[model samples]
Target: MANNFLRRVDLIFDQDCNFKDVLKSTYQRSNDDIINELLESGLKGRGGAGFPTALKWKFTSEQADVEKYIVCNADEGEPGTFKDREILFKVPLKVFGGMAICAKVINAKEGFLYLRGEYRFLLPELEKQLAQFQSILDELKIDFHIKIIMGSGAYICGEESALFESMEGGRGEPRNKPPYPTVSGFRKKPTVINNVETLVYSFMIFRYGAHKFKELGTADSRGSKVFSVSGDTPKPGIYELELGMTVEQFVEEFGDGDTKAVQVGGASGFCVPRKRFKDTIIGFEGVPTGGSMMLFNSSRSMYNVLHNYLEFFEEESCGQCTPCRVGCQQLKLGIEAVKRGERHATYLEQLQKLAQTMKITAKCGLGQSVANSFFSIVENFKEEMIY
Candidate 1:
């Protein structure tokens, strides 16, 4: 808890990197050396899932297939999340370098960056930096190369399997699991798909060494995360900070004086009311996020907040599974009914149960995680949801 204070870290945005130096240093290290460092550092997928980076690369590398792929999930469609766009904008090269390193670890000759459709403006500058990067790879004789592809702004496409489907010229829908991306991904080959910030941290871990990274944050959540702070905040912008801090500490720094609740993730994430702020830690040990921290003040309506998020989930659901597709619509309608006094407040208990069922039966993370915000808001702010 000593390190839980909101100390700002500048490793990702330092701009002190020379990709050649990082990659050249990488040239001397074997795949085991690279993977071992990642494992030691405990670097997880910063895309909110928190899967270990080392295992994704190691598992993909272990596949017998000769045609493995590495993908950067750049679909920044999560509501209240915009750090990925900033990372790509301010430090495109680091993102590329991170992908290159992963490509090497998995023996991948080709990598793809799935850029969000709205970020098309970045392609020109990204291409220039990428060409320069590939030339350096050519000079070093590294066998990796990367290409850029644009997304269609489907929120579900942010899921790894759905993104793969879109990349394969099919609809962006999530595939059933057990055969994850590491086993069968784009083209049904072995793949390692990491988020934009995840890749940047991978590169930074290599550049700064894993021990230094390990020294920060708690045991379960190692290293710093880039957070997109907005809504009822004095300082509403991107800030990289160490993990394991309570929501209270966060509100103290970023919250407007009248802050009432904080949405730790995005629309699909949990809503922490002011009462639980002191007890809630914003990490895997408590509530984990994909780096979207939206603060709401007392002036705002929790009912409206919950409504907006439910509507987003209802509209964005791919509608593949009944639990998710129908669940979202019913949840929205359920709350509306309660607000209008059309249903008894006790009906919310049934709706909460429905959300819990969706958590179990929903096919993808999109439908599954809706329960997080639903339960958190309804349980804590029950009065608002009713009247």
Candidate 2:
């Protein structure tokens, strides 16, 4: 454990007791009380967006849909992030219990665990766990049931709207906003979709009172965060820490001595170089992460990092909008062109502007977030990017 690392709520790893009875007893509480407790805890979505979990539940629960859903986004495809796979493999019942709790709150009869295609090998065991949970729910006389679906390994499916599209038997492309998922989602019904970690926390918040959950982390980012720390680090694995630690603290604990930069929150997340480590916080107030903390040392090339991310975006972009489709290719080629001396070093300014346009007009988060690391790496590591 790193400095200031506190693990109070245990849902997945190192859990001793079965949580089924706890979940069964929770139904005695009113939906309003549960949602209110969640709101008071200041719990945010662990799925990168950091949206308030209580608000999403309240929105879907208040909707007038006959059939509602609770979709657990287990498609942990973000590069260098694999914490969900461990949670699904080890303690899937907690996840299902969390989902069943949500279904009870929102009056949802059905729920789906959208497992990543890469985790297909864990399906048999996950199904077995779900069956066991289903039996528990049946014993409790809860009308809700859960089914598992596997994704086709698209990185874009990690996005909430795109995940919905994939769940609906269509290509995993993000839908436009305004009629957000709470209003109409998952076969055009009111739905509440939460990341695997978020749902687990929901169960934890219920188990331990909201006040206890609020004791850890900063004001905005309350509670613990499970980080999938990898790359250039001495110890690369999942570590749960109280949310408001600085990047410097994280690096000191996990990073190699030669660490130069840390990409907080995977490729789409911000790039925090060593210079800003002390000033940068790791929680929602500073650079909020979705469980990916990739440390890079002096040996790693910033240009290659940006190039790899751009390549991912170019291949993963749905290409529904011109900004994301063309901007990704342009950014990838722009960096390559500079490296090849085909384009002048000053051309990076123009490329930055192109990236800015993509942030504004791109259809989904996949395209908009490309500018985050792209501009950060290009601007900070210009010397390394160009000759």
Candidate 3:
């Protein structure tokens, strides 16, 4: 088993033999065998939501709908999440292999990789890689085919339902629940939507067997995750590190000595002040992330950070629901009012209360998760907002 220390693993990008070999062997296994292996491995989605990948596959496979689809959520539009783009650019074969595995398990013949509009530059090479990957699929006689779909640059599309809407030629907005992607997705059929990194991990798990991954992280946060580290860090880039490590340990490795706070997960993620670094674990048992870690030194302003996040949510909010639409607008305005000495510092509490309400009343994760960053910042750095 793995401990809480940050261990840099060579699982994801480590390549040895041809990827087709891995696919050839994986395709040999029964669906039950593969799903059982994935279940035992405890692999979860790397897309921050952390749903069990095995259950997603099992659920989709169990569904009676033969006209199912597999979706690779390449809409990496989160504020600080760029690892998926890097994965798609560097090792697209692993992504395709993972999709093919899922397709076999679910008995689907077609899939789509919802590419972010901002990443239009990667299209040409990505298509080139896709051709090669498809050739391998043909050689292996796997009927599964993967296609790339373009996104119109909406951050909400990172949400599965919203991405489905965009794919179906509708406006990029979140639909209501009770009809999740697994049961009704991508043309109202069963769909297994996996993140770009999650798919790579799936491919890696099947390539290296389940226990190799299951032995990496703590029980709840099994396996290593790739993080997109940015802001104030000397070594800001994509890193594949073990989970269950403290923010303090992460800072020791990636942060400057003057680091004041670390934002785990992107703008929507919780902000940890310097004082709380040691206590904060970067995993599901602590602060679950979609693999974005941002460091801020004492020189950086917490108020500005909060303001910037609020502005992001306000601009990104689909405006479908009143709480997110109004909450994002007011939170940004409310923080600004206090900063400008127009409102009493007590008004900060009101903003926090509103954030809490939005967490409950808002329709989707975009609206619900605002309170994660909002309250964490205001509570830890109240003085920043007042003066």
Clash counts for the predictions, in order: 0, 0, 0
Weakest lDDT window of 10 consecutive positions for candidate 3:
1-10
Task: Give per-model TM-scores.
Answer: 0.98, 0.97, 0.98
Candidate 3, 1-387: lDDT as tens digits: 233467888777786747988899999999999999999999999999999999999999999987999999999977788899888888888998899999999999999999999999999999999999899888888898888999987899999999999999998889899788889999999999999999999999998899999999999999999999999989899999988899989999888889999998888889999999989899999999999989999999999999999999999999999999999999999999999999999999999899999999999999999999999999999998899
lDDT-based ranking: 1, 3, 2
TM-score of 2: 0.97
RMSD to the hidden true structure, all candidates: 1.6, 1.4, 1.8
Residues 252-356, candidate 1, lDDT per residue (tens digit)? 888778999999999888899999999999988999999999999998999899899999999889988999999999999999999999999999999999999
lDDT of 2 by residue, 144-203 (tens): 989999998898888888999998899998899868889988897899999999998888
Off by over 4 Å in 2: 1-11
Native-to-model Cα distance after best TM-score fit, residue 279 in candidate 3, in Å: 1.2
Q: Least accurate stretch of 10 residues (summed lDDT) in model 2? A: 3-12
Sequence-dependent TM-score of model 1: 0.98
The residue-level lDDT of candidate 1 at 159 comes to 94
lDDT for model 1 comes to 0.92
If both were scored by lDDT, which would come out higher, candidate 2 or candidate 3? 3
